[model samples]
Target: MKLLTLPSFLLLFFETAILSNFVTADTNVHYLDNNEFFKFSNPRQIYGTKPLHIFCYQGKPKYIIHIWQSVILYINHSTDDYNQFDGGSPEHVEKEYLEKRYSWTSGLFSSKSKTFHLNPFNTSCIGIESQDTYSVHLKIIRVDLWNILKLVAGIVFFLSAPTLSKNTLFHYVCGVSSGVCASFLILIYFLSKLFPRKTFMYGVIGAGWTLVIYFLQILWDNMKTILSLYRTYVIWYIVITGTISFILCYRWGPVQNQRTMNLIKWSLQLLGLLLIFFSSHFQEAAMAQVILLLLFTYVPKRWVLAPKMYWKKRFPPKLKPISNDEYYEQGVRETAKALDDLRKYCSSPECNQWKTALKLKDVKRFASFIEGNSHLSDEEILEYETSIREEVTDDSDNGEDAQFSEDESS
Candidate 1:
């Protein structure tokens, strides 16, 4: 009497697990809910600077360093809780940036600020409030040059790959997103060092822009369901797809000279759009999650980072399963061409009589265009030859009427 849905439920659970982030206690130095750290200051204090940290992106959950897309350590000015200077209410200032409700794009009060609280008395208001401009002394931490360079280099290498595929737009989008984030991080790094305050402001701009884009994606995804405008979405999808196509086909995909990659890029985009159109609950948040999952799961496999997953794991990365361009470059296309020819020739009158070569195995082997012997023993070849003879003889007898007319007419 047990139901059949049990296995499907288990599958969904595992799917979620693969997408979840692994967090360490050390990474989460501080854990503050909305009211605890980011609330308004007690009306008792007057003036002082406390360290304030406003984060736009958390690279991974539960990490000690608390890597962010952008971090601005503000020096808050306060009185009652002197250990930390609460940097006025930041919510007013973050109106343009704090859009991703599902994520902490606006960050939290020091979940670990208490541990790192340098100012004994002024610590309370360090990251609170937004009035005291000097109360918030912001510091932008630069991503490791190596990490930044690695992302940049990896993206370049991926693009440089003799095989660029067109089926997986998510992979390309991830590469593009990583490259952009890294480039901006680098720019902010140099700018923060040289220009200081202005650079931090610009960093805020970049961080806001990043969140904005993420939000837009979410909005689009959610709006389809929440807004109930499938027709408009279809229109939007077409416009965007068409525009992206023109850009990729005319400008980047071909000009860069990788047609396979171009095709993959376009195909994925179109498929993603179709998925967006059909799926009722599809949200930007969900799509972003899927993109991230695909990035972690699919891209590495394409790079041959490991062997393929099996049916046991459904929804496994199917991004251009094998890089068509690279395979073609590796002479897969030529082999295919030869096999096609063999298939045709085997069906012809000259070879159809012997019919040995007409078998799929023989044709495929011959089409492989490999020069050396297959190492098959004479016994093995004889066995295969016998099978082919029997099949061909039967086929010839059955089709005699069909072939007889052609021969008689000739």
Candidate 2:
């Protein structure tokens, strides 16, 4: 079973690799929402005689739609009533509903791009209804890469989760999630700056900053312990808790003895720290080191050498033998009192017959018997009592039969 672990992980890794490629290829399908742009290209013989329609649904509050073509063409925009022309062609749309929308005549001979801020709440489609007999290509560019990357990253992350330890996986997920969120917020912040008209961007930015500050404050609160643990385990304080460093050094280093291995590992760790300190992302590396050390120290171990060695060296303390006589006596008294209460409460003729059937004269012996059979369940005790009652009934019947025989003989 243990030998199959590596092979299983390798199989999973290959499967993930193949699936990632499959997903990337599959993203190019003709779903408007999946793509960054919706494209229209005229065929070789076909000119711009037929109208081209681009449908939009579930539109946002604002969409910066950029429409560019290979040749000059007249483009018509729909009003806010997007659903009015649901699945309707441009020719079928009423002329009265056609509003004076965005137009670019500057590049009459060459292809020019026209931008529009469209709200697709009611508008169904953007149409190019020009009757011009020229080959034309149109492209509508929107936000695509970031959204696609997020989806792909999420899929890969989820698939890879089973291969990682809980702590490592948690850190990875938190880091990726926070990094993606921060990147999105930064994008939004810049977008808000560029488009001062979007007032809600400011509120979103403020909320994002507030959450970031709150988390930073929490990190600050635990900064002391974090730093202490890192310094003690990951750096110079290697005599006790540098399990990772010790293992790596002992396994690969040329040193054979414990003292020499410790010295070599400490030196190597110091060198690593120095290199990290000089790097461009010193702060990130430092924090990551701290987190790594924290994880290493807190992770549950199956066998710890230090604890085992300490226990071995320490002498076992002498303990006096404790007697359970007091407890036994207390239990006997309680049982006797309970039986007496039961006997007094059950004063009916049937109860008296049952008591006589039991034939228990010594209450102490009965209590001892009960204590000895205390492990038996309630059902077992009831069954035992029933059997005793049956035996008493049989004995009484036999005595009556013997008395009748004696009377008959007399």
Candidate 3:
């Protein structure tokens, strides 16, 4: 049985390989037109600053187009016209700038034609231009059914290789194989835009084999018994859900406040566990529960949270401390202001009555006397009052005739 399996596997592999080769041969033919021809020139007037060889194509959404170039030269693609390269702009002044610009591919020396696969996402037009002085002839072809079939074949081969083994570790092997295949799919999808088709295929095949061998060794050494009980499955499911929740929280939780971030993290974790628990109990609603969990995981946080919640608090700036000289200056200014206000108040007519009520004619003298003498005997206070009254009587007697004449004139 082992010998028969080996021969059958080889036969199946060769059959698929031969069929793929036939498909490639048939799809290699392309229809050409004179209008498709483009010329790139290094004009002496502009010093090769302008990209004369530009081909603009109307592109559809989610469609990938393949480009074949006849010369070894750097290529770039943009969603708009290549008018920016017409002048000696800062963006294209240096040779290295074109190499680092958007959707740029480095030049490679090759005997065969170089191919570029592009996905023009949502752009109405795509402009393909050569960054070098070399004259480039190229063809643009939209990916057709046969090309898609070839891609699907490659993907299937990558995913189905591990299943060929008849070992009891089928589940573990298939899991690892699928993960590696998905990673390669994403990598190839992006790399197809940056590398020629031949270079992209060579890299994918080489990297795929290396990872497959490494993962196989890991699986061989770590094989364990598979738990088959329903209760065990439930516990594993809950643990998996909790772990996914934790990762999501840490990656996409609120960052405006630390406390809010923690609250959101814990809430999501608890909610994930509860959903798993309830889904297990209510088997009929399990699908709905799973859908809800997926929505919570993938939905944009801004759509769920208010716009104001994303705002961060701005703290007031720190003030510099005042020096000793500054402090003394401030104190002097305040004291001068207070004395000016008191002088203005004393000029008013109410000042005489206030001074009489306090039995103090001059505010400065009253303050000095209080500071010097803490207490006074009753007779001393009486004598002080009698002296003030006798002074007042002398002033009144001196001004009596003048005050009486002024009143009569009024």
Superposed model 3: Cα runs more than 4 Å off = 1-35, 45-55, 61-114, 120-133, 137-146, 154-162, 165-410
Local error of candidate 2 at 38, Å? 18
Candidate 3: give the clashing pairs. none
Candidate 3 per-residue lDDT, tens place, 1-410, comes to: 99989999999997797556434321111112323544444444343243322223323333112221111122333222232221122222232324323223433211112233322221111123333443223343333444344334433433343332322244234434444434445555576567667876777766765655565554443333233335586466546654554454446532455554455445445544444433222233434545565576668888767454544324445789999899989997997777666655556675674545477556565454334432345788899999999999999987997899999999
Candidate 3 TM-score to native: 0.20
Worst-scoring 10-residue span by lDDT in model 1: 21-30
TM-scores for the candidates: 0.19, 0.18, 0.20
| Deviating ranges (above 4 Å) for candidate 2 | 1-50, 53-101, 104-172, 177-390, 393-410
**lDDT by candidate, in order shown:** 0.43, 0.44, 0.44
Better of 1 and 3 by lDDT: 3
lDDT tens digits by residue: candidate 1, 1-410 = 24678888888986576334211101112323222323333243444422233422112232323221223343334432322222223342232222321246434421213212211112222223222332323333433343344334444443433343423454455455444434434444565566557757776656865755665555554554645757676566556555554455444442333664566555544454344322212234335544654575457565553344444265565665558678767695687667667656655676653356555566555534334434355798899999989999999887997789889999
* Span of 10 residues, lowest total lDDT, candidate 3: 63-72
Candidate 3 scores a C-alpha RMSD against the true structure in Å of 27.5
Model 1 residue runs over 4 Å out of place are 1-40, 44-126, 129-248, 251-253, 256-410
User: Sorted by TM-score, highest first, which candidate order results?
Assistant: 3, 1, 2
